[model samples]
Target: MAKSEVIDVRVSRRVLWVGAEAYPLHNIARATTIRIEPDRMAAVGRFLKSLLILAILTVAAVAVIGRVDWPSGSGQDALRGVVVFAVVMVAVFAAQLLKVLMTRTYYALVIETSGTPRAVLVSTDAREVGGLVLGIMDAISNPHAEFRTQIINYNSTHIGDKINQIGGIGNVGKRVGS
Candidate 1:
């Protein structure tokens, strides 16, 4: 890790018996989870849409110009082109649908293709996660930034109380996202 590289390390609260996995904050390259597939899909869709529109416009212009012999089987060629284009559009739609169905949202310590730990935690509240990650990373890298005593809760009641402390009382009894 470069000294100038900013990395945030978040601890994930896993299952009860498994314990929290945030500290010994080494090899933590990021605090936030990365999402890539949706953007990729959008880009591909944009490209295909533009290509489709261009093809249609080109065909329309050719028909209007009528420079080619219209009576000598060019109409059959145009029909063939239209049929092929429609099939391609349907194929693209089916491929996109299959990709959507196959893709699953994962929350894990992913290794980038370049072989690096991508993040320290997943599905974190960005507001709290960043500060905590920075704090811990700083403490580890610079001894003077050591963390002071802080409450660590192990039960639902204590966790709820802490959440209430942060003015999340309304979310106390509900499951996440409820």
Candidate 2:
């Protein structure tokens, strides 16, 4: 297994360094932490919905086959095809469930600058990120405050698009009767 990169973070009165990316303290509008949790229930709900649709389709197919009188061989072949399709669908759902179940919770150091808000550092360790946030806050308040820390296993939470998509669903951002 590859060892995680020991990221360098430095906070002074002027600049904040996360890895090699530096943000001047004056340009940093806000600095905070966000928890990224996988929506496991949503994943399970989707799986159940898919399963219901498959069941409904299977029932409809069986009902149609029963009502329509065809050659004996043709009816059997159609039933076999339905079974194969159902099996494939089940396999796909199982894989999706496994991925959801295996996902872990992550903490992110979100910094909002003049450009766009970005997650400068992400890790599974919450305390480390929290400490970093405190350090940044201290630096902003006290000019002489400074600190350095190392972070290993920098995992990404893929939250860049998610933050921008908030309140974008339904009629939140749309004008009615436009």
Candidate 3:
């Protein structure tokens, strides 16, 4: 299957924004927005660390209790068990702790149509997320327009008749005629 057919966009040193060949850029019917969320696997390392710690603690407890040899004085004692368990746990903890560090964020590019968002492009690089979102918006707004600046126009004035309303529907014409 074609890469562009399945994925809405691709990124590297630069982002390659593409849509379905049938609809292309002009088929982008409505506005879109970008939302940043923690990746689903962002806490996977945390889960692994929790499991590792739990295992180590359980094993240490077992070793502490199991070291007491009833008859044989030559058996490994509790002191050795405690020391060995501590060293192993500490070493594993540091290694697993690096994996648990939260460093990835998910950027979701929501493509809307007739007010409902249908397509979403997710990315790990949050730095380019905003730019990609703007690029998509700019593409939708003016397909031929170049991505000149990151200056987003937040103030899109959409006025409605409700602005002049005094209270409710009862005061709609009352405020105007008076």
Candidate 4:
């Protein structure tokens, strides 16, 4: 006896030909590539966290010292208060400086990637930075990812043709919309 085989046929929604083989467009042949390295941002986050912890510890120590009374005529109590105030001021300054540094770094990274296929690379990096800083260090790193995504999506939709006209990695044939 012989057995019969059944076959199924269906129309694909979209198709793409990379080389000689055709692939369904909806089926991702490759995962979305990430050009930005998360480790760099993670390292920055760790540094900020350590700085914050040190600041908190220093302030606590100063508070403990301020509470104790020393010899009245020695002027040690007044010196202790001044030292505490100075340490608190330094901590506040360090926090502010770190914040500014992170902000500048985020913007620099964003601007550097503009007009490239990895333009969204900046957005992803910024997103990670913002998430880590806001989540871990209580800092406002960069709240621009959503806006950046919107802009990138819009450009990829509308001005994509113009971008392709210029001819680069972001060109039509190489990119999603082209």
**TM-score against native, each model:** 0.33, 0.74, 0.42, 0.23
Q: lDDT for each of the candidates? A: 0.46, 0.82, 0.50, 0.38
Question: What value does the lDDT take at residue 140 in candidate 2?
Answer: 80
lDDT of 3 by residue, 84-163 (tens): 86677666765655544544444555555555564344455455556766775666666455443222122222346634
Best by lDDT: 2
- Regions more than 4 Å wrong, model 3: 1-16, 19-23, 29-69, 72-78, 112-127, 146-178
Residue 95's C-alpha lDDT in candidate 2?
Answer: 98
Model 1: per-residue Cα lDDT over 1-178, one tens digit each: 1012223333333211112433444443444434323455765676578667867876786666465567778777876776677668767766775676465433323322234454433332343434455565565466445443222221121233322244554554635665
Error of 4 at 154 (Å): 14
lDDT value, residue 93 of candidate 2: 96
- Return the lDDT, model 2, position 98: 82
Q: Which residue pairs collide in model 3, if any?
A: none
The residue ranges of model 1 lying beyond 4 angstroms of the native Cα positions read 1-37, 40-48, 51-55, 61-67, 97-102, 110-178
Q: Rank the candidates by TM-score, best first.
A: 2, 3, 1, 4
Candidate 4 lDDT, 1-178, residue by residue in tens: 0121221111123432221223333342221323332354555676677667666866776666567775764456565765677677666756765664554222111111123422221232445434322321211122222111121111121243453355357543545644
Give me the displacement of residue 23 in model 4, in angstroms.
30
Candidate 2 per-residue lDDT over residues 88-143, each given as its tens digit? 99999989988987887888899988888888878888998898888887788778
Which is better, 3 or 4, measured by lDDT?
A: 3
Determine which window of 10 residues in candidate 3 has minimal summed lDDT: 148-157
